[model samples]
Target: MYLCSTMKKYVDVILPLPLNGTYTYAVPDDLSLSVEAGCRVVVPFGKKKYYTAIISNVHYCPPSEYEVKELFAVLDDSPVLLPLQYRFWQWLSGYYLCPLGDVYKAAMLRG
Candidate 1:
């Protein structure tokens, strides 16, 4: 038998776009159980197109800028990123002198 986890918190995510930084989203009551740092979520970016973004951090404070949007869906049952992975990406960005989005694009293109 299988069981689903419960969600009880909200999170603010940082998308790798030119936009400012961090968008807030509410965790579904039932799905929050598996949500955590490094989890990837499919979210509506602008008008069309959904992008897979890593959950940078989770918080309870309400967004102070724009209205928070609900997450379109969770993509993984567990977090996809680890601390080392994040650090590596950071290092790559610094060494390459490029935005993280460039690295993400390269990875996606290869796939």
Candidate 2:
């Protein structure tokens, strides 16, 4: 029998804003396997207004500096962007000195 790691799980999400980094969010029992990279998830930011964010990384390490919040909802049955596209976004952000979210915004808008 195989056992999953005991480490706490967290999902790094890229919000649809001009922000620089992905925010970590806690994964409730109901959303574990349903989430994946490049998938859209609705997450509450600040006091209100749930934003559709892209799941960048999902792993078994919870952040230590702040409280992680649960995902509001997962909106994609299939991933929105491929891993190659993610790599391109990373390049765009680094080369342009822009936020990954900005890259995502530009990518998401291109029909």
Candidate 3:
């Protein structure tokens, strides 16, 4: 993956909410490395609490609907998760009939 300093790219993130799909956010220049996939970030969702979400992917296209927001903060200097971990969570979520956020919560509690 490219480092965060090259160009400011907007990313479309999938929050662990019961919503439709992804939301767009502006990635800050200084926070490039911190915004990679599997890294957690604080984002403003709706009008209330700032939700912690993972950056699923990065893109250049602007969102068509809602106004994209700036990333509030990145929660990690390096990715907290690996590809295998993500696959494991996906399997657990499917088998347990639970949300991915629930799995994330359980992992956090153990840590």
Candidate 4:
């Protein structure tokens, strides 16, 4: 069982867009168990399309700038991202001076 805490868990997701940052989504109690760093999830972005995003970070710290959006669905039963892979993505993002989202799309894209 989860201990009671004032701070709630939040997830930072990487979208396929070329944007430089990740979006924060609040994890509801029902979906908390299933969400993890490195899994792909479906989230409603903006007013329209729902995009599949890579779960890059999971933490208790909620973002201060904007209200977090709720996740629409989880696409993976298990984490598709390995811890090492996650680390590499971070390094790649910094080294290449490109958004992690772009690297993620390249890595996940299958022909």
For every candidate in turn, the CA RMSD to the true structure comes to 7.3, 4.4, 5.0, 4.0
Please list all clashing residue pairs in model 3, or write none if there are none.
4-32
lDDT of 4 by residue, 3-95 (tens): 334567778899988888889888887888889888999998989889999888888777777767889888888899999998998899999
Q: Estimate each model's TM-score.
A: 0.71, 0.88, 0.68, 0.86
Report the lDDT of model 4 for residue 37.
86
Candidate 3 lDDT tens digits, 5-101:
3355787665666544457898777876567777888898888778887776766665656666788999887777777887897788789887776
Which wins on TM-score, candidate 2 or candidate 3? 2
- Number of the candidate with higher lDDT, 2 or 3: 2
The CA lDDT of each predicted structure is: 0.66, 0.84, 0.72, 0.85
Off by over 4 Å in 1: 1-8, 14-22, 108-111
- Between prediction 1 and prediction 3, the one with superior lDDT is 3
Best by lDDT: 4
Compared to the true structure, candidate 3 yields what TM-score?
Answer: 0.68
TM-score, model 4 to reference: 0.86
Candidate 1's residue-wise lDDT over 1-111, tens digit each? 112224336675656553433566777666676678878887777778787777767755555456556677887887777768767866776798877656544543354
Question: Model 2, range 14-104, lDDT digits (tens) per residue?
Answer: 8878898889888787888798888999898998778888999988777767777899888898899889999999999999999999888
Cα distance off (Å), candidate 4, residue 62: 1.5
